[model samples]
Target: MTLSCFDLGERMLSVAEAQRHLAGLVGEPLAIEACPLAELSGRVLAEAVHSPIDVPQNTNAAMDGIALAWPQPVAALALVGRVLAGGRFDRPLAAGEAVTITTGAPLPKGADTVIMQEQLAFPGAGQVQVSRPETVRRGQHVRRAGEDVARGSLALAAGTRLGAAQLGLLASLGLTGARVHRRPRVAIFSSGDEVTAPGAPLSAAGIYDANRYSLRGLLQALGCRVIDLGILPDDRETIIGALRQAAQDADMVITSGGVSVGQADWIKAALAEVGELGFWRIAMRPGRPLACGWLGEGRTPFFGLPGNPVAVMVTFLQFVQPVLRRLMGQPEWQPRRLTALAAEPLASRVGRVDYLRGTYHSDREGRLWVRPTGRQGSGILTSMVLADCLIEVDADRQGVAEGEPVTLQLLNDFS
Candidate 1:
């Protein structure tokens, strides 16, 4: 008896549910490694980082000034000594006397306030006059020790992805190395006999495989260790074999095409034979036939994206990338969204969330405007290349009128 193909429900999994499912499948924790700060970018912190010492190490001047008691009348202050950064003043400062200190220099003993050099009048003869203000507070202009970070305080929590800013913060705390989660291994492939590789001469009916390349590039941008499984023909046996092999070695397996309802599409049948098909046919345009499941005996998470070039890219960014972040132990996995005005009217069929490729730029008034690239067809890969964002139109909204507000998901912001 032949196994029957199941039509997955239109029941779309909430973004949270998708994340939890992927996390459950990728149950194994990544082994942590002590990586140098230079190599820590885009890696997840496996351990909480604590400040070993105070940020300033001591009370220091925030400006170049005379460190002395405030409210002193305009009088000659004997320049008893000078305090340079990294140099200490051992002698105590007396009343009516000022110590010349540069920015970041430690505050001298018995001196709390810092009067800027500009506030003092130089009368020559190694003396400077100060017109002190009334009711000046002690420790003014002083950056106290640990004001920014205290010793033993939590500097960064675990599961935080280290970026350039995070790296700089760790470096400021004298961290030379950090324990970070290993990159998740992802295997990418595309199916369809008509798809041919680029650089190869195309037959009369052949089409170059864009989904594989686009998905691979997106995975790379997400910092995944991608394994290109190459293209597979739409044969059940071959698809099942390739998926099983990929599931054996990869934390996740991603494929494009063969996910929709068609006689030649074999990914669903192949997944059911190897593991389990969880859901498909999400209410999203250009990607409505999205499918997800697990494969292999271990049940590695898998994503079956639509064949259209734009749909493949959009679905991966919206669904697969977040799942990858969860597998890598990142706490905040959602992409940033921004609001922009529609540059022109956008027409769409209702019932499916449409992700229209658009180019966004700020007008002189500092308002963001998004204009759809010509030919919003899903098959047009060039439109995606020319687009910087995906303008999200709701499934129930037929279209967007000109100058209307729309939420856009950035595609090339980091790049």
Candidate 2:
């Protein structure tokens, strides 16, 4: 059955709603693979990791110092012996005796504090004098075994995204490899007869296909394995065939354009013929005509984005990214938003949420200021290229005035 634009918009899910829906649909667990620590970057851990042993392995000096009992006064004491890292001191330090130890060196028997070398004055006759007050405390400047990570403790939780710090933690736990969820396989394409490949001569109405490349890069940044299906023309038959092929191999299929109610829009019909039509016409500007559904007997999900460049990008980031994160078994899969003052006035209609591309900066007072990139038209891809963030105007709000505080969604980290 054909779904009306308002009906689709009303049924259109919020970002969180879409994520939950997709998670329910894809309830099956993702396949986990054992990957070397080096290759596990950006992958989600599939199993909880426990530390086999304690970090530091033993009590060691935190700095180069004389290992001695605390409460020792500024009296000359015999320099008994020296202990370096990885060396054991079999002899116990008696009263009026001190042991020289370096940073990370194991504490000798009877030594309870580390006195920094600079705090002591060494005389010619194998003795030293400490002028500081009784400042040294027992067990000062020492790292105890298992203080960081105890054996059998949870080192990393399942579904944790393995980043640089996570990798280092795994290494410290003596883990050479990790079991991580397989990267989601996504197929991306752009539709429209007027869309031509870059570097080619443009016809009177043809424009370069930026959405395909842009979406591909976005998917890659999300750690998905992307299959580029290239650009499909506006023809219904060709679009359906390309989508069918993509659905057969991909976990999710994504395309831009030809989903609206216009006469030339054939993506809606093509999607219906191949799969169950879910929803279209989201309550969003530059992306209201977005469509989402499932394809194939297996119900592989698909996204039909608007033809306009800005619409394609905004819709993908707001909608499709979270679903991909769920498919990869990521625990927290939400974009962060921050409030910033509008640098200038922005005009908008009240029915749809508007994502205006803009540059964000911090003033001397540390207040965030956002200025929209000129030309808020959905067709203008250049605006997005120049923008660092998308200033979000709520669906019920008409517009924002200069110096008014509004929420800003970051597209990329500038710092």
Counted clashes in each candidate structure? 0, 0
Candidate 1: list runs displaced more than 4 Å.
1-29, 131-141, 363-366, 413-415
What's the lDDT for all of these models?
0.81, 0.81
Model 2 lDDT-worst window of ten: 1-10
lDDT for each residue of candidate 1 in 171-276, tens digit (9 for 90 to 100): 9999898998888899999899999999988989989988888877777776789899898997899999999999999988999998888999999889889987
lDDT tens per residue, model 2, 1-415: 1223225454654544444454554555468899998898888888999999999788789999788877765378788888999997898888888888999898887888888888888876778777674675688888888899999999999878787889999999888999989988999888888989999999999989988888888888778899998888778888888878888999999988888888888888898778877665466677877677778887787888888888888988887876777788764667779999999998876766788999999999999999999998998888999998988888677889899999998996311
* Model 1 residue-pair collision total: 0
| Model 2 alpha-carbon drift over 4 Å, by segment | 1-25, 134-137, 413-415
Give the Cα-based TM-score of candidate 2 against the true structure: 0.89
Which residue pairs in model 1 clash with each other? none
> Model 2: which residue pairs collide?
none
Cα lDDT of model 1 overall?
0.81
RMSD of each: 3.7, 3.2
